[model samples]
Target: MSWTVWTYVVYLLVTVPLTVWVARTLSRNGKVFLEDVFAGNDRLAEAVNTLLVVGFYLLNLGFVSLFLRVDSTVVDVAGVFEQLSVKVGVVALVLGVLHFFNVYVFSAIRRRSRTEARRGAPMPPQAQVAAYGPVPPYAAPYPAPGR
Candidate 1:
């Protein structure tokens, strides 16, 4: 019945499942681009997924712990709910923004990789700008056969 208890319940109720949902959605939607971003390495994608989940847990836990420590000193259920709602709402917003940032960054990386791939491969040594002059055919004498 205490406000602290309610605050905790709401915090967990909202944060845990939401984070899982976002991570799932991201992993699913980002699959198409992940291959390009990290060279189709499933292991890298798994690592990224693990890292993201860990980071999400740490950040959301920090937010919950900090939110619970507010100095208001008020013990009313209403006050607790009000502050908890605001805190959880802010956390949701932050998660959304972070999700978008993750997607955008990876998308950019993927685009850069694709661009690099699409560009013609490295020029052969002989075709480089420094070697533009017409080369004598392989059959030509190395030094005017008379030499």
Candidate 2:
């Protein structure tokens, strides 16, 4: 077969399995975090985890498919390697970026949950004012009496 065909084969071989492996890894490990974030709601956590997995598959596979085509013709084995390198490299980079994004978002949710748990239920606005005492008149944007 031609180098172009080989390039396509290699790209598919590399990206498809990589995508599946990443999705599975994330789904498996993320369940615990999701459960914690949902505060022991296992059903809700499972549902959200499934949804996230589906979304991850769609995005990664779509990107892989879209990026499969080489911009230039592969002239030889070297060209094939070069093209594959660029394609697979981009896919790897995108995968890392998406993974990091998911981690960051989930971490934020977990952190917020921890904070709320520590603080208990939120205080109402009036309760806050009452607890802290009324806002001083001088604290307002308007000028003070002597000013």
Candidate 3:
């Protein structure tokens, strides 16, 4: 209905893809933080990236819509340009936040998995019981003295 609405729509159309592209580029580069957060699994990493992109879309779109509703009216070409500048600036900010969040989350997963691996594989349920003491009656003991 207003020029601000059109500007907001254009802002989303341009910046959401840019944000996703930046995130994907960072993913492809595979830094320690990204690998740590994604647990070094390529499939899981891509899936997490996809989720972040979706969240970015939702967040940016909502922000643009909200900004449109605010009292941001411009009387002429200069005014429209001013609104565009503000809109683009905000979009850039949202993208930065999404980029950092993606990096932070994946790094956490990678670090957790690395810690687990360093500790050696965990004992299976039965092995755990055997390691600590005897098994519970329902668990059935090992081979009863080998026949």
Candidate 4:
């Protein structure tokens, strides 16, 4: 096989496994966060987590396949390595960006949920403002030195 073919093969071998590992890690480590984000609704959290993993797999694998082409001919082992570096580097960067984006979104959800939870039923007015005038004067318990 040509060096270009070899490069393609190696790229697939590296990127696919890396994608799988990242997805698995995210799913596993993200469960608790998701649950909190969903306000401790485990079932909902699990369902959403599964969907996210599926989407992640679809998006990344599709990207890998679509990006597999080597625009220039790979004539040597160095060329193969160079192409692999660029391709794999792009994939890794994409994964990192996606991971951080997911974290940011879920973190926002979690924060909102906690904020709502903290804001329980509004407290009754502690004391109603009888009027809006500032004509009150201090009446000391004991008359001033010489009232």
Better of 2 and 3 by lDDT: 2
TM-score of 4: 0.83
lDDT of 4 by residue, 1-147 (tens): 999999999999999999999999999999988988998899999999999999999999999999999999999999999999999999999999999999999898888889999988864454233344443577456667865
Greater TM-score among 3 and 4 belongs to: 4
- The list of candidate 1 runs beyond 4 A from truth reads 74-77, 125-147
lDDT of each residue in 1-147, candidate 3, tens digit only: 566666656666766576657655665665444445655666766676566556666776676567554365656566667777776777678767766776676567667777887898667899777779974778655676667
Task: Write candidate 2's Cα lDDT for 1-147 as tens digits.
Answer: 878888999999999999999999999999998999889999999999999999999999999999998878798999988998889999999999999998899889989988888987767899989988998766877767896
Candidate closest to the true structure, highest TM-score: 4
Q: Give the lowest summed-lDDT range of ten residues in model 4.
A: 126-135
lDDT of each: 0.73, 0.92, 0.65, 0.92
- Score every model by TM-score: 0.69, 0.80, 0.57, 0.83
Better of 3 and 4 by lDDT: 4
Evaluate candidate 3 by giving its C-alpha RMSD to the native, one decimal.
9.2
Q: Report the C-alpha lDDT of model 1 over 22-64, residue by residue, as the tens digit.
A: 7677667666567557887988877876777678677766765
Q: Global lDDT for candidate 4? A: 0.92
Between candidates 2 and 3, the TM-score winner? 2
